[model samples]
Target chain A: MSIPLTLVLGGARSGKSRYAEGLVTAGPAPWVYVATAQAFDDEMVARIARHRADRADGWQTVEAPLDLAGALDAAPAGATVLVDCLTLWLTNLMLGEHGITAAIEALEAALDRRAAPVVLVANEVGLGIVPDNALARAFRDEAGRLNQRLAARAGRVLFLAAGLPLTLK
Target chain B: MSIPLTLVLGGARSGKSRYAEGLVTAGPAPWVYVATAQAFDDEMVARIARHRADRADGWQTVEAPLDLAGALDAAPAGATVLVDCLTLWLTNLMLGEHGITAAIEALEAALDRRAAPVVLVANEVGLGIVPDNALARAFRDEAGRLNQRLAARAGRVLFLAAGLPLTLK
Candidate 1:
């Protein structure tokens, strides 16, 4: 049987990562955390540190600043995996000038190959006013499209706001 | 009995206005469409015109770019009213250097007195990464606070994505 995939979409500080962690922790211990955030600045460094301190001891984190598919592939079979975020992963790809389409396909293939439950966390970035900068606009558009695609492929989809979860599918 | 109030929150082009219109139109003819959009650019002018053309003939449009509370108070009793958005109204308020707190109080008072069914549309703007500018950051925080306040008072609340509604409350 195919493993269940869940897509958790939320805004910044909307408790998406925490919620996804809870989902992973519900079934078993020793979960794999595929973190995609790159600490380019102090703010991100602080955030990454905070997230690390938030969870319990059973999480084995795999850093995948650009190689998310490969990191997920390295996770053992039947071990629940929580991908802290896809937004930062996408940002990494864009900044690194990697092909987004190909990266997404590889990620999809990796997900298909998984034999354990996987929960993907993503930011819902397109719900706000259009940005003045071209890059911000393009990023929001890409984030929205990515979210819709992942949500469609997932068995369950949830939208979170203000630390509350609302099931979308 | 207090008339039902619904808050429909979504990103740009997420079909929020259409959903709110549906809620108003389900009741009776001659519904009030309280438009808060001001066409400062050609794109906005075209978008406003398109939205007007998209709706049916039963809508009585009211231009309330700043005086939203006053315009809302003018609607007849028992006539369902659809406020196309609060985001643009907030933008107008901020750009005009108006007092946001006082205006929000007036709006809340206006909502409290309404005996007609009301559907409010607002863009969810805090989901993206931290914006580069202070103004955008402030605007998003204000928007988020506004949504939360109005949502608490609303009889029904929905968060929309890709034209799909996820009931939040």
Candidate 2:
């Protein structure tokens, strides 16, 4: 049987991570928490540490800022995977100059191989004023494109605002 | 009868303006286009021009770059009003050092006086990575608060992504 994919998309502080975590912890314990964040500074370090401390017991954390597909593939059999975010992963790919299209394909293939349901979280970055820098603009466009692509294939899609869920699909 | 207010919230290029226009035109002719954009540079001018050129006939355009409340109050009795966006109006307010709280309250009061239906468009600016500057951060926060506030009272609220609407209320 095929596994289901749920994409939770929202803005900063919109409770996307918490919401996705709820979905993960809802089913069973020993959930796989795939962390895409890479802490380079104090702010990011604190954010990462906070997320780690906030999660309840029975979560197996996997740090995969760049190797998300590999991380997903390495998950234990029949484990529900919750990728807390793809935006940071995409940021890492872009900053590290990785081939994004190929990485996306690999991630998709890994998702296809999963035996358990998976939920992916991403940010909706294209709804505001255009960013000043060219790189930010390109990133926003790519992020929006990636979101639309995944949303099309996901079994369920949600747009979150102020901690409320609006089912998009 | 009390007027109905619909708030269309979306990211940049998320088809917010187009979708809100559809709602306005669905009612009757001679609709009011309450524009809140100020053309200070080539980009701004170009954007305003493009939006102006994109609209269909029967739109009575009103330049309300700063006085959106006044514009709304004067939107011809029984005319269905479409405010292309509030983010820009907020920008103008902040730039002019206007009292944002009072402005918002006045705008809400103006909305209450409408004898016909009204549709408001706004950008969802809080979803992406936090901005670098304090001013931008404050703006984002205010925009979000404004959206949440209006959305609470709005008869209908929509969040747009990839040009698709997800009902939030």
Task: Give candidate 1's error at residue A81 in angstroms.
Answer: 0.9
Alpha-carbon TM-score of each model against the true structure: 0.61, 0.60
Best by TM-score: 1
Model 1 residue A142 CA deviation in Å: 1.1
In the range B1-169, model 2's lDDT, one tens digit per residue, is: 2569999998876668987998999998769999999999876787799889989999999999888889998878889999978999999999999999999999999998887899999998886677888899999999999999999889999887855687888
| Residue lDDT tens for model 2, A1-169 | 2669999998888999999999988997669999999999999999999999999989999999999899999998789999979989999999999999999999999998997889999998786655888789779867877887787678888888899888888
Q: Which residue runs of candidate 1 sit more than 4 Å off their true CA positions? A: B1-8, B13-122, B125-157
TM-score of the second chain, each candidate in turn, equals 0.97, 0.97
Per-residue lDDT tens digits for candidate 1, residues A60-163, read 99999898899888999878999979999999999999999999999999999998899999987786557897788768767877877787688888888788
Candidate 1 chain B has its poorest 10 consecutive residues by lDDT at: B12-21
Candidate 2 clashing pairs, residues 3+ apart or interchain: A11-B127, A126-B12, A127-B11, A127-B12
TM-score of chain A of each: 0.97, 0.97
